[model samples]
Target: MLRLQSALGIFALLLLAFALAENRRAVSLRQAAIGLVATFATAILLMKVPVVARAFGAINDAVGAISAASRAGSSFVFGYVGGGALPFDLKVPGADFILAFQALPIVLVMSVLTTLLFYWRVLPPIVRGMAWLLERTLGVGGAVGLSTAANIFLGMVEAPLFVRPYLSQMSRSELFLVMTGGMAGIAGTVLVLYATLLAPLIPDAAAHFVIASVLGAPAAILVSLIMVPETSVRRTGGTLEDPEMEVASTMDAIVKGTGAGIELLINIVAMLLVLVALVYLVNAMLGLLPNVGGAAISLQRLLGLVMAPVCWLMGLPWDQAVTAGSLMGTKTVLNELIAYVDFSKLPADALDPRSRLIMLYAMCGFANFASLGIMIGGLGVMAPERREEINALGLKSIVSGTLTTCLMGAVVGVLS
Candidate 1:
């Protein structure tokens, strides 16, 4: 009975997308069916099948090893202050320190490793295979397909570069998909860091993150197609050409990758500082208001009020819905970083196991206000002519991206 209710909820969300579609008449039922089935099958396989579960367990073990390696580098450079082993008795847990030093360094290391893998031609075949899968399943042009697949591994800005040449020629729907795909999944650089933050709160954290990204790819397609159906007839059905960014050699790739990682690291730290401070200020003001339920009203409470309905729709039990909703609200308004930070602090008894798992899939994405700005700026500079279009679609992309994550959460809710 619960599964049936969850399935109905998922259908309603899809219908909501259809109602908001730019060209309702252009919505392709065939494409939508394919995407939905593929997404469902992939999620079930990754999260449930015994053989696949074992593989994900191995992946989780690998992520643990990588986290340790990243900490080794962080310790060597920043000492005990950055989660490194030290002889002194600070007696503080590693999670207590500034995230920039302790967590963001993982991003840098992952970036370098990702670059090396690409330089050695290790990632291209896999990327192409995934792209091929999406293309064959959705009947999308190669360029759109490739960019969507690349988003699973690359950041929003970097993923579109693979299909840069096709951007100008892409139809409105294709462009929408490109942007939607970028926002729907996170970059590889920070996947491990997120997995680590979530490790204590959820089991198989690394595997869940991986599954969310993979499953979210198809969900994004389905959501994008429904919300912004392909009405334009122009199709750039060309095959993907390997995009070459200038890296003189292996050493150069490492240097460039590190530099890029530093830029991302600084950006994350700055955004978190400002956004967190803003949230504090707002909460302080809100504290002046009358208490609710014998406790002073807070930003968290307000967000919970706003998102609780959506969470309930996603099939969360009413008791856990508000807490999970607050997390989703935080992710949308502030960013997933602070959202994850807050989620890690939730008391074990505050939520049941099922709701906790649902939130895991929900919060895994780059869809937030800050990301919208970054996408506009990054993709704007890449293709100056499309800047207006990028700006125009920015808000809609956020909606589609948020819906994609919720859609994934809904699927998990049904299956669980």
Candidate 2:
């Protein structure tokens, strides 16, 4: 039954993309088949193969160590508020500061560490290798391949810097692929923070997130290709122009990375504050509406109603589908951060282990409405000539990205 649902989910996503294609006649079945099979095979290797699983295990241990190191720094600076022992003991019965001081600081530490590693020419090789593999396996242009691979570690705006020279020359389909890749994958800077938030529920949360980002890259390209097939000829797998790299030293890299991380931290905190308050305000307004079964219905309930069908198609039973659907809606409407916060707070009995796992993967992406604006602002600045095009394709890319993440969830469900 789970396998059947997974198959149906895949078919539904493919058909939906085809139905929404700007050039339906241009949609290539051969290309779609290759992409779908590649994505499925990648998922299997990451999740099912024992050798690959062990590799991921080793990587997870490293991430765990990073988390510990970040905590050590956080404890030193913020003291007990950062999940450490209180400097001076006092009986204050309250929860530790998890979000502001603990989980969020990991982003800052990772940003510095990642920047230092990039300065040492560590990440470029990995990004280029993945991009090269994608180019060979999926027959995509280098610009799209490189941007997609870089999105695994960097922000949507920052990743495009790797292929900035080619952005103006890319076809509509290639630009769309780039957009979808950024939307579909989470940055490494925040991966550990999310893992920290979700670790209680999912013991191997860092590994799960790593797998999602890896699987999402190819899936993003597949959906983009189907939605907007390239009509014009473009170069495939060529040398990337080295942007004038400038970092005075490792210290400079760390300083700049930490500054960038502070900006991200501020954005995250403010965004969540405004969004959460908006949700509250909307729910309060909704409270005045007539109740069903003598219970007040809010935005989440409405969103749940709309999204429940999608959850059902993804193999969630009806009894659990509504709650899972709410999380999906929250993810798409708000950002994944808020949705994850809500998910972690869900009662233990609200969802079974399988349903919870499926929803976790399904809701793991940056395909919300806010991200569309960010992409336009960030990517637009790089190539002002393409701003209009970016705006035009924003909605389509979001749809493609959302479908990609959910499809990933379905595939994992089948294998599980």
Pairs of residues clashing in candidate 2: none
In candidate 2, what are the lDDT values of residues 1-416, reduced to their tens digit?
87688678778878888888999888888888999998989898887765775575565566567667888998899888887896665663234546678766775776677677667876556555654776667878666787787676555655665565467777888899999998888766567667777888986787788888788877887888999987887543444443343578988988887786676566655654665577678889989989976878876677668878778777777888888888988787777877888888999988887777777788878887667666775567556799899889998887888888888888877877
Tell me the lDDT of model 2 at 280: 75
* Candidate 1 accuracy as lDDT: 0.76
lDDT for model 2 comes to 0.76
Instruction: Give each model a TM-score.
Output: 0.76, 0.75
Reference-based TM-score, model 2: 0.75
Q: Look at candidate 1 and tell me the lDDT of residue 398.
A: 81
Clashing pairs in 1: none
Scored by CA lDDT, what does every candidate get?
Answer: 0.76, 0.76
> What's the CA error at residue 341 for candidate 2, in Å?
2.1
Candidate number achieving the greatest lDDT relative to the actual structure:
1
